[model samples]
Target: MENLHNDIYPAIDPSVTKSLHQPGKVVLITGAGRGLGRSIAEQYAYACVASIIICARTSTELDEVEASINKINSAVKVTKFQLDVTSETAVKQCFEAVKEKEGRLDVLVNNAGASLEWVSIDESEPGKWWNVMEVNLKGPYLLLQAFLPLLVETARSNNTVVDVVNISSIAALLTFPQSSAYQLSKAALLRLTEFVDVEYKDKGVNAVGLHPGGVVTKLSENNDAIRPYLIDTPALCGGFTVWLTKGARTWLGGRYAAVTWNVDKLLSMEEEIVKGDKLKVKLVV
Candidate 1:
């Protein structure tokens, strides 16, 4: 089972999946300018969502993404924001803007993340080492702070399940040398997911930590050691995310999911997962 992996399947395919279509739901995706974020945004459009809030630091990329969404589904209302997720002022403003315009948010994808050169702590530049935390960790924290209230409100009034997808990495489970910043941040994020789920499960908010498969992108190309594992594509991330939000997957709340896991198998193991409290961050005895 350790070596096994899976890819995209019909159940999660937004373009053809009937069960996964979100007709009236609004979704917000960070780092949507390109790569996996772009793919996730596109999948939502294909899922027939009512609107998509696409955010990134680059206006040009957002413009291109907006245009692409228009081509994919002109009916999808696309909103673009040139956002730097690490900036508190920007995140709060984004929250206010979304709250004002949409009045509610059904999905928030904390997909904006950063990484730094693999240098030992002793030799690492303080700014560079900590910047990764600011982007990968602090950004999501601020977003959560700013938007969670809206999510909770939406859930209470609408009586529906809202999702928060924190994009974690497989590295969170590894102990690779010189990869401390990214690993620790992701590991902490899983705990944050737990806190969010436990705190708001009764209110219909489901927070999930997801490990998107190793899809090679601009942010990842510089690393040579992990190059071979970059065999997956952005569609896998997008499709799996759709599946995660297809309905009220409360059983999966506060858990870790990977795109490489076969959805059918994953579903079949729900009983085992729930009974054993699996897919969570824990220490081995």
Candidate 2:
């Protein structure tokens, strides 16, 4: 899909009532300490979500985001977890904590990821390459396992839909040199998204794989090859996420989206996209 806007416009900004204001939802985000993760959390705060749970490896980063959330919306309850998303026990414990306290979870943003040195399979450190898969692929799976019950229950109780946004990448669809571990992990995530939607859509759960635009984050900054392409604002992905989740966007379930794509344009193309199964991973793609 062609991108109509590269940055935040009036239509998708978190302050846009028609597009972004969805109050009282409970959201949990992994990697919420910094970069696109923090951006997504902040946008949810702007939407006046009832509570937000943020998890990251660094306690200091979590503290900063909590303070930022407080400034954005003091009424918004903020929970912090110093977590490794790849740890099954930790993820399950986080799940228990949220289930006990919130009793519901409306959205899960699987944003925690790892990217080692950009080296080819032949040159890559075996341990480091495997770590990317652990964080990128297995991490989301752990989260889904831990949280899907509460998400499904939340939907059942509300008679509405909940969401799982797997933060995949453009690399999932395209190819590049020296990106096998990262790229392949993200690619598999799209299939995982599809599987989740098929299994749970009738039960009121939707999952989507997303590319969070090219932003100059701490992560992206380390990749010299993509420096010139990191032209997008951090707010673009943040606001796009708020827009995507405002309502039951089951139409977009089990597909892919890029924050750089104009959301209104995507909505307009919905019928065509659904009919042709566009934006999905397949043999042609």
Candidate 3:
């Protein structure tokens, strides 16, 4: 029998998936092959997103995710691209493919990561830091650069906005001596989020760093020592991310946030979760 790494019990709520109903909106997700990415993709597919572009390094893995979505709703359009997000050429090609297939792109979820390994900084080698930076920071930056045109076009042509949600970590803000490289990259990712917000705010493109508080996944399951402290699940993170994109235009952007905190804002009625497919907007008029 294969080893079953059960870091979290499944408590998936499909109701959280109702945010992606823009009729013809297009979404592209990195690292959609497994873990939280798979969960996020499942929820988006369930919401009847117009088009979902799933990318990962393994063609077989991408195919698996695509096939799984097809099983749930065969009419939902899912395009798979074999990609290593760290490569600028690959990122450019993937964005081009999205432009070709979808004509306009509406959302991007930067979920690809490289800092899955857990080891004391003292025990880690030099290449570890480089690998983490390459995937976590460089990849997302390249994706944003390559896709900015499509995002701008989407906003202008369709009367819809573009969202870039960067999946960061609490480790970025809190000290985690075990993985310094991961910490540094995620912190920089938050900065990148700020830059995106500043540069694109006037253009109607919203970007933010979302810290999915300790979601159980392959990285967390592989490390037995730190798994106990994590409280959130992939499904919860996925659900929150989809909703975040739906309403991030009104919510403050360019800062780090978590589901636990944002959901509390909803519960306390500081922010109202809008009904139907429209984004929640604060009344200023």
Per-residue lDDT of 189 in model 3: 89
lDDT by residue (149-170, candidate 3, tens digit) is 8898888776666788888877
| TM-score of every model versus the real structure | 0.97, 0.97, 0.84
Off by more than 4 A, model 2: 1-3
Order by lDDT, highest first: 2, 1, 3
Give the distance in Å from residue 220's predicted Cα in candidate 1 to where it truly belongs. 0.8
lDDT string, candidate 1, 145-249, tens digits: 999999999999988999999999898889899888888888888888899899988889999999999988988889887889898889899998888988899
Model 1 weakest lDDT span, ten residues long: 1-10
Using TM-score as the measure, name the better of candidate 1 and candidate 3.
Answer: 1
Q: What is the lDDT of residue 163 in candidate 2?
A: 93
Alpha carbon lDDT of residue 268, candidate 2? 90
* Candidate 2 structure quality by residue, lDDT tens digits, 5-57: 66777777876665477777999999999999999999899888999999999
lDDT of model 3 at position 128: 74
Q: List the residue pairs that clash in candidate 1.
A: none
Off by over 4 Å in 3: 1-20, 116-122, 262-285
lDDT of every model, 2 decimals: 0.90, 0.90, 0.74
Q: Is candidate 2 or candidate 3 better by lDDT?
A: 2
